[model samples]
Target chain A: MFKALSVREPQPACADVEALSETPVETLLELIDKAQQPPWVGMRAASCLIQGHADAVQDTLVDWVQQEDSRGFAILVLNQIDTLPQPVAIAVATQALAGPYASDATSRIAKSTNPALLALVP
Target chain B: MFRLPFALVALILLPGCELLTGLLNGGSGMLETRTSSVQSQDGIATIDVDVSGESAFQLTATSGQLLAVEAVNAPDGSQPLYWDDWSGVNSLTSAVWLEGKDTVLNWPVRQADGNLSDGTWTVDVAVVDDQGYYTDDQVDVVLKLKDDSDLSTGTVNARIVYADGLKQDSVVTAGVQDAVTRWAEIWAPYGINLETSYEDSSFSTDQPFPGEGSEQAEVSSGANGSEITVLITETIDGSTDYYGIAGGIPGTLDYTDHALVIVSWLTNAGGDGEFSDDDIRLFGETLAHEVGHYMGLFHPVETTFDYWDALDDTDDCGGQSACESALGDNLMFPYPVCDWTSCTPQDQLTSQQAGVNQRYTGTL
Candidate 1:
């Protein structure tokens, strides 16, 4: 049985932000799953994924949003996707807005400066 | 020789028309008036008005009111300010009365109704007889209000991380929620509300107490500029003496950022075990106290200076025993004791405390 430890400090992510960009998509997905272990680390991983592998990260986030157990974390990830490249970020945000996480996705998209992303808001 | 103004001489002589015959006949002699230099401190104005050859004098305000006497120079140790409650009035009229001649009447000026603001004001001093007759020889004194901004409102987001085993207990979750609710109610007047969430962790139960080694670094990691992160566990380094510990001094960056509370200690402090009413109350108060520090409130006597909480109304007990007796129920007191049936109301936040708390910039 895992001992219950309430850790207040942020855990060191599996990889640093710079190294996370070069890390493989599978590793990034695993880090996203680590959101259950320590939420902040997962948030940092998601940020790295959005900066590094936007397209793959977008697809993974959309899939996570589709799942019942992972939807909350996926919404948090989608919120961080604003830093992604315009076209890829727009596609991920559009899919998120069309899914169960539409409200959160719409809010994130509303903050974008890209016309296509802004147009998808309504 | 320089001559006095006719109007001034007339004012001195006429003395409210009724004294005309007395002055002409030299029946009661003449009234002499002298005012000292005015002094202002902490939004209060004080001055000394000396009157001789008059039975009594009345201090009237053109804008503000003559509040309580903060100090006096009288030899008899008599308080000059008198509070009079009139039958038909809703407010008490406070005034400075001079019973005899050659006494300096110290007057403190404060806001009256909505007339006082951040500017200079003039107060009128007139002679009054036993029959309510007022003299025309009125003197004007000036006062100024201090410039301090009003208090503001803020939001707190509290993240409660429980040990994995404790997180499974429904009682723990409910108790934590109740505690947060109580804290919100206590701070609602200050415009502070704790938005709380709980999480279960898989880390080891060997977490260090706050301010020891890496614990602070770890705990503060979850903290953001706008919210506080509270780590609740079964015990704090397995100590029962302390129910909760916060990081840093009040108004500092570290203090506003993180707090660690031990739920087990709070619950079992009186040997009643978990989920008891006393446990819930203690838990809430502990959280409130720690967060109070996060919001920049120091223990009334814990500061480097003597007996300072920066508020005038809250009592200051110089030492531990005195505090336990006189200020035992103060929320910011050093330690609190409780039992299963009832607990002390150590949860009250004074208005000045609330003002200091609301001045922090850590709101969402």
Candidate 2:
């Protein structure tokens, strides 16, 4: 169960502490650095789009999609998207997985067998 | 350190062309309320400004009306919150403000190169905080634009319900009500604002042993203060098809007293389809854009374009993959015959910047 946090930029975007993966708080700065690299390239930067649009965080990635990747998108598959400690984050993400890629052939991403997330976050 | 004169010249010149930040006109003219506060909700504020106050503020060039804007966010003084009105969008910046508003304390709009219409507008400062209802709480700011003989006008006061089409207040996220709120906000800059009563579109989504279907639901908002009333009718007998439309200017509805009706096919529900964020934003954009036509705005590039390409097409999330190139990349892109997402979030936001109540501009 490995979750990856992808941030294209630091400071206001990835920052420190914003990555609350249950126990510790570390800057996803490393995640940003890693996700933008190979093996992760073309591998949708999940938060690359969400992180850039999070409350208080400037939505630079949304524009990055237009100016950078016009057709394809960058996403990050995460073992966990719950740091907000609230279920709304999962609800929001569920709304995400429900749309766009809901029909993608990737059975893992589409069906979302892990109903555990819905119970945990909301 | 060495070239002090050059440094001063560069700094001075940059201030004049600061782009979206010019809302203040380098003075104290621009007053903005932040919608960055977030509450326990997923990520949307339920707010509605009383735009129908008895005391009207004449929108002169120098002194515009007073408006109280609201949004959903964390309470003030706790944490700095920043949110974009447009979510579910992939290409455009959902949040539009100056690069450093909290630091510099100046709110600006994010207008990239491709906004076809003139989108130099500012966020209204009514609510002053970010945490608001999913529907925006707005001030009743009355305005009168210049008299353009060609400018056709109408009002669209509505209460959008689900396919059953009855008035139900159960709230659904990223629902049709949210879509319409976004539309009205886009049309806010224009003279089209949604009525306060119907602002929050928390319609009922209840079901029953209910031999009823979601797809064949007749969802239409109640008509009140609007000259034009719009209703979204669904025709599926199963778990009905749904839609989101902001009734104000962003709905792109220009009629003063007619219902710019929107209908969705029965099969569009959770029935398998890869819905793109681009498509959602575009759907919100296009439906309103077409409604704008109902209000009397001509197509930006209707000469060689066709709106009929989407008559029965549902493949590209209501978008016609073929007509993107022929039409001028704008809200009114001329292809009205399909179901693909036609309008972009930027198009709606930019259109909201029109400011129809900003008094009759001699230049405009």
The numbered model that scores best in lDDT is 1
Query: Candidate 2 chain B — worst ten consecutive residues by lDDT sum?
Result: B3-12
Q: Mark the 10 consecutive residues where model 1 chain B has the least summed lDDT.
A: B2-11
Candidate 1's DockQ: 0.01
Segments of candidate 1 deviating more than 4 angstroms? A1-122, B1-150, B213-216, B251-270, B302-308, B319-326, B337-341
Against the correct fold, how does model 1 do in TM-score? Answer: 0.40
Docking class of 2: incorrect
lDDT of 2: 0.27
Which runs in model 2 stand beyond 4 Å of their true positions? A1-122, B1-156, B165-174, B188-192, B196-222, B225-227, B236-260, B265-276, B303-327, B336-364
Question: Model 2, B114: alpha-carbon shift in Å?
Answer: 30
* DockQ values, each candidate: 0.01, 0.01
Global lDDT scores for all candidate models: 0.44, 0.27
